[model samples]
Target: MIGICKSFGANKVLGGVNLHVRPGEVHALMGENGAGKSTLMNILTGIHRADAGTIMVDGKEVTFKNNKDAEEHGIAFIHQELNIWPNLSVLENLFLMNQPKTRFGTIDFKKMREMAEAKCQEIGIDLPLDEIAGECSVGQQQMTEITRSLMLDAKTVIMDEPTAALTERETDRLFEVMKKLKNKGVSIIYISHRMEEVFANCDTITVMRDGQTISSRPTEETNMDQIVGDMVGRIMSEYYPARTNVPGDEIFRVEGFTQPGVFRDISFNLRKGEILGVAGLMGAGRTEIMRAIFGVDPHESGKLYFEGKEIHIKNPRDAIRHGFGFITENRKTEGLILDFSIERNIALPSEERLAQSHVINDKKEFDFSSELSKRLGVKAQDINLPASTLSGGNQQKVVIAKWVGMHPKLLILDEPTRGIDIGAKKDIYDLMNELTAKGVSIIMVSSELPEVIGMSDRILVIHEGRAAGIVEHKDATQTRIMTLATGGE
Candidate 1:
């Protein structure tokens, strides 16, 4: 793509940007959220038309009017949000518009299943073709999306945050897949915020900032410091903020928590002003345990204590009433109402506080949301814009703001910084420090070992629905955590 220019009303999203990817090379696209990375990709994939630009394929200039047109040119996009039909079976989703037909003009179920199975084998994975797409894990769904692109015979594939929801082992598998694609001479446009992944897997790096290309260099020539500085236009001295709040006496504790076939005998204590980090592999029950504590899921048996007094929490409302807040892992599905305005989402959790005599005060709601937006640095035209309009980082800030408005004593953050840019991650870490300073306890569940070590006062390792052990920040090493997470003592 050459001289790509795009605008959305008054917002000039891309200002004369350019990108070049070679065949069989994994090119990494680096940028903060809203830096026009998605806009550029959208223009390239024909999701949106560029105001002024030229796309050259095989040294021939071509214009694409729609996604299908781009696909015809062997270009495919696997979006960050996997665009699989939840109600449809895996085979059905894979061959939705391009199913094989028999001599009688009927869809060929046997052919479709055979093709799906062959594709999975080519990618070195096993997937049930008849299973519902929604029933599959995030990693499996990702593989299905990739298989679809390959089935289209795509020469140029674009993956946006492909491994954001994947576990460490799953990420390794994805890297292997990418390598196989490269060996087959297929070009890949890799977009991600994880610097480690970029350096480890990509052959070239392209940095974008403020809607324009800053620099593009070979992976061998550029380092993480240079790439990060170029992307964010600043030198990040420290990735995590200093922990200032000293933990106080135990304020929350769960004893013998058992959720059949989920987690069992989970026991832990959270102190005031403490940040307790939860570490585990995917499917190890880290999220399930937190869900039980927050009353989103019921445990078969458990004893909960708050400030040394036993308490009962039968549902989310009960937990919320007792000053508990939860930031779910999948923000798009569970955290925010995509169709609602920013102000409305911010006021959702605190509706009772913003109500008077069983009626909501619109003005008060607006005022509170406005204040929270400013406090959280949510970038938007106004508070009345739909929550879906904001970028990933801003959307995440809205979720945090919603819970912060409720002034909860204990906050549960599940994958808090997942898919966010590095700059936004720093802002969240700072916010966590500030919140803890005010005596708000935090329980953070993260798959990133570096983050868990950098931010947590204590790290609790969970292995296959059981607590392996808890390690102090000073003693928490990646190897130690991995050992415990893999069921070692």
Candidate 2:
């Protein structure tokens, strides 16, 4: 794509952006969320039209009419959000519309199974063909999506944050697949926020900021500092800010939290002005425990104490009423209503407090949400715009802003910075410190060990649904936490 430009009304998303990907190369597209990487690819795949640009395939200018047209031209896009049908079987999902037909024109189940099994074996992935897609782990679902794209024999594959949901093992497998595809002369456009993955796996790196391409270089030639500087337009002297707030007395406690097969014997406590990091591998029951604690799910046996008083949290409303806030990991589905305006989303939880005599005060609601949005540094032209109009980083801020408006004594953040950029991550870290300084306790669950070490006053490692050990911030290291997270001493 050369000189690509796109605009959404007054918002110019991509401005003269240029990208070049070579055959058989793994090119990493680095950018903060909403930096036009996805927009450029969407143009390439015919999801959206560029106001002005040129797309040349094999030195020939071409235009794709739709995603299917792009696929037919050997270009496939695997979005950051995996598109999977929960009720369908893995095999069914794999060949949904493109299934083989028998001599009599009936669907050929045997042929589909054989082809799927062959593809799985070729990629070194083991998937249950008949199992419900929803029953599969997130990693499995991710692999299924990749396999679907590969089945089209796509020459150029655009993968957006493919490793966000994968475990270390799964990520390694994905890297191996990328290497194999490269050997076969297939180009991969890898879009991710994980700097380590980019430097280690990619052959080239391209950085975008504010809808424009800032720089592109071979992976070996550029360092992280330069790339980060290009991304955020400044040198980030500190990735994670220092915390000045000293933790006070215990504010919340969970004892013997059990949910039968999901999690067992989970015990932890949160102190006032503390940021407790929950560290564990994927599917280690970390998210499950958080959901149970927030009363979104049931726990067979557990005791929750708020301010030293026993509290029975039967639902999320109960937890919220008792000053608990939860920022769910899947923010797109659980955290905010996408169709609602940003102001509405920010004011959703605080309606009761912003009301008088069972009637909502519109001015009070708008003023309250607007204040919180600005405090969180939410970038938007108008708060009246739909929540879906903002970028991933800003959406996360809105989620946090809503919870902050409630004045929660304890907040639960599950993968708070999962799909956001480095600048946004720093912003959130700073916000956490600010909240803790004001005496609001936080329990942060994250897969990134570096984040846990950098932000947490105390790190709690969960191994196979059990608390392996708790390490103080001074004692927390990647090795120590990994050892504990994997059932080591």
Candidate with the greatest TM-score versus the true structure? 1
Alpha-carbon RMSD to native, per candidate: 1.1, 1.3
lDDT of 1 by residue, 249-328 (tens): 99999999999899999999999999999999999999999998889888999899997889999999999999999999
Q: Which stretch of 10 consecutive residues in model 2 shows the poorest summed lDDT?
A: 388-397
- Candidate 1 lDDT (Cα, 0 to 1): 0.91
Off by over 4 Å in 1: none
Give TM per candidate.
0.98, 0.97
What C-alpha lDDT values do all the predictions have?
0.91, 0.92
Best by lDDT: 2
Q: Please report the TM-score between candidate 2 and the true structure.
A: 0.97
In candidate 2, which residue ranges exceed 4 Å CA deviation? none
Measure candidate 1: CA RMSD: 1.1
* Candidate 2 lDDT: 0.92
